[model samples]
Target chain A: MALRNASLSVNKGEILAIIGPSGAGKTTLLRLVNLLIQPTSGLILFNDVNTSGDDKHQRSLRRQMSLVLQYPALFDTTVFNNVALGLKIRGCPETVIKEKVDNMLAVVGLSGFEKRMVKTLSGGEAQRIALARALVTEPKLLLLDEPTSNLDPKNVSIIEDIVRAANTKSQVTVVLATHNLNQAKRLAQRVAFILDGEIVEEGASKEIFEQPKDERTATYVDGRMIY
Target chain B: MIYLGGWEEIGFGLFRALQLIFSGDPEVLRITLISLRVSGTATLLGAAIGIPVGASIALRRFPARTLLISVINTLMGLPPVVVGLFLYLMLSNFGPMGFLRLLYTPEAMVLAQLVLVAPITAGVTLSAVSNVDARLKEMAVSLGADPLQEVRIILREARLGLLTAVIVGFGSAISEVGAIMMVGGNLLGYTRALTTAIVLLTNQGAFTEAIALGIILLGLAFAINILLTYLQLRTKAGLFAAETERHHPVT
Candidate 1:
């Protein structure tokens, strides 16, 4: 499939979910958005500014968006330090850093885990800390790569709630990639069904879940196990 | 030419050797001290140049990296005799560096060891830096750390391996003889070290004294190895504990 021909826009404060089988390029799409891997050919506009020329410009654009990997890539450091890292990079003042980290951690329901080591955290707890790490940067957009995959059902619900709340409270655009249809319906306003490196269908989450456009989307939403 | 084969004779010879060492025989004492000093200097100088060079290579991409690494690997295996002869030629009166008059001096011995050890140090340090977790670099860059900041992080994570590199370099320098003997002239009470002295005593039929010096050199090498092993183990344990204590299950 043509990699860069696909186009999808995430509006400010809108939660867009992309659901697909494994090897459908869902993670590749997120990686493209994160600029970790550039598309062979495509237009990626952040704030209507094309960031394809200089790597520095692309990095600057990246600062405006945070991508949370499926496995929370926390540092081998304390939770507080991990959450404070982005601010530290931006050279934020000490007092401001402390305040923002505390607020962010609290929002992610990890208020007292500041000094805790990353290795001791459970999968869900680590994911929450990862969320706080991303949110502390105050990015305009947050892209998640199956953030709830390793989480328990309870943690999954909590993560869904937190994503919804983040979109509402902070007006941050949320783009979640998952294979779980129920989560797509619960947390996303719009859903895009991808298959074989192509977006098969794109529409409102409710309509897409109830009335999938393509056979692949229908099979995927119907839980026929496309993967 | 001579035959004095007896247990009593052997005992007497060993006793005389010990007496020579303890009574502060200037020649023996001077050689031991010079060896240590030269080896120490070379190791330190090697570290000063090697670690940073290795770190830079590991962190950045440049043309000729493969060629550079191949050259370093080849240098790591360089023959001490060849190095000694090459330096001897370069520092002779007819050569450009002859005005410095460095040959047959402790400094010359040190310079030779530096050449021999620098490549080993750099190669080991490069491996250390390369083995550092890539996730750490990605994490640092993702946080907008500049190249310097990223390298600092790499160095911090690679401290133990760098220390090992220094220890190994020192071990290699201390045991080398050809370079020291050639450049140091193995001069009496001057630039002689354990290896050169052992060679000198053997050449002069001082078998008992040479054996004694050989024993001491072996002891020194063993001690250095033990100390370095302890240091390596301690650093690894410390890292393990630190990682566990601050363990973020992420990348």
Candidate 2:
């Protein structure tokens, strides 16, 4: 019941935003792409290869992407270990893990926080750490679910900047899900409007916001779409 | 008539036990050491088997999982005498495992205690693992951790709870007398542990020696409890600190 007949694709290095009201299945759609959950009946093709066969192949495909949850879900360890987890799992050497983790922390404005316990971090700080952890692996695709839903303006702006930098500089494909229309306009190249588990309209971000083809999309962009 | 001079007798017995303790009574020390060794080995074996079983049950979903959990929970409170009897039958001369000739030996006592302890350890560990946030597991998977890596991460996060399980298993194994006495036969200078020895001394009218053994058992239990409790408190404090900071961020 969460999502049905929802199909979309992303270009390499392009940012796609999924905008919708609460219960519109934006999070569910993102989770499906990340392979955290499977569709009851659908095919997900990664790099033109169907991702629904063979456990080993699925795992290999999964390793090429990362997902950041709406709320930060950090390990109960130091910040360094959190960011180094993916690399370690992939059998990266310790020296490389340390260097990459350190650089990623610095990029997220958390320099010198390698030894800080994750539990002691503030919400914004924790979310930033989650981002750093996700991006440290340099995944081919990064899916975020309302990455800035509850953050303050300053933290929100900082996160937006980080996501932009990751897409432009690292060429990581990004799919961000949020209800914030302005955020979609600012960061996403293409936008999809989801309502009740279906994509109502999909187009370039500027066109979607400026001249929406669907009446519901226009009402949603105008901030008048009721739950 | 038998109860005459009860208070004075107990006071004198207490003083005598203390003297015996300080003077290094070989029999008492030997009994205490044997108790520790048997129970300690059983606890280690129990944890080795129990933690993984518990974690697997918690993480995997299959048919009869609820039934398995219920069975484990029931076994956690298994009567010591019943376990002793069950193992006695299995290890008896006419039984299938009789070729090992482990009956009435220290190993048999250890086996009995292991049976008791393993279920307690597993049940407690199951509860602990179940308490972990489901989102954490999802996040780990989303961050590219394979199934094995995901399990390792979950176990690491639940380390404190696992430690508690081991401690509880040890406590259960160390405190029981009936099961060990039945399987070990409480052989003098061999399998006689603190609990069995205390019973022997008390029955033989050596109240002073019994009281001394009792004091040592209490002291051991108290020490282990205190250490584990301190550790639990520290872990809880760290979690609480994180929770507070998360909810109330500094400007």
The candidate that wins on DockQ is 2
DockQ, all candidates in order: 0.18, 0.24
> Residues A1-227, candidate 2, lDDT per residue (tens digit)?
38976988888899999999989999889888877788899889888989886656777888889888889888887887788877777777777877998899999999999889888998899999999989998999999999999899999999999999999999999999999888999999999999999999999999999999999999999988778
> Which digits, one per residue and each the tens of the lDDT, describe model 1 over residues A124-158?
99999888888889889899989999899998988
What's model 2's lDDT at A139?
91
CAPRI docking class of candidate 1: incorrect
- TM-score, every prediction: 0.80, 0.92
Which stretch of 10 consecutive residues in model 2 chain B shows the poorest summed lDDT? B242-251
What tens-digit string does per-residue lDDT give for candidate 1 at B100-192?
A: 999888999999999999999999999999988886677666655555655765676687888889988999999999998998898878888
Per-candidate local distance difference test: 0.82, 0.87
Clashing pairs in 1: A73-B251, A118-B247, A118-B248, A119-B247, A119-B248
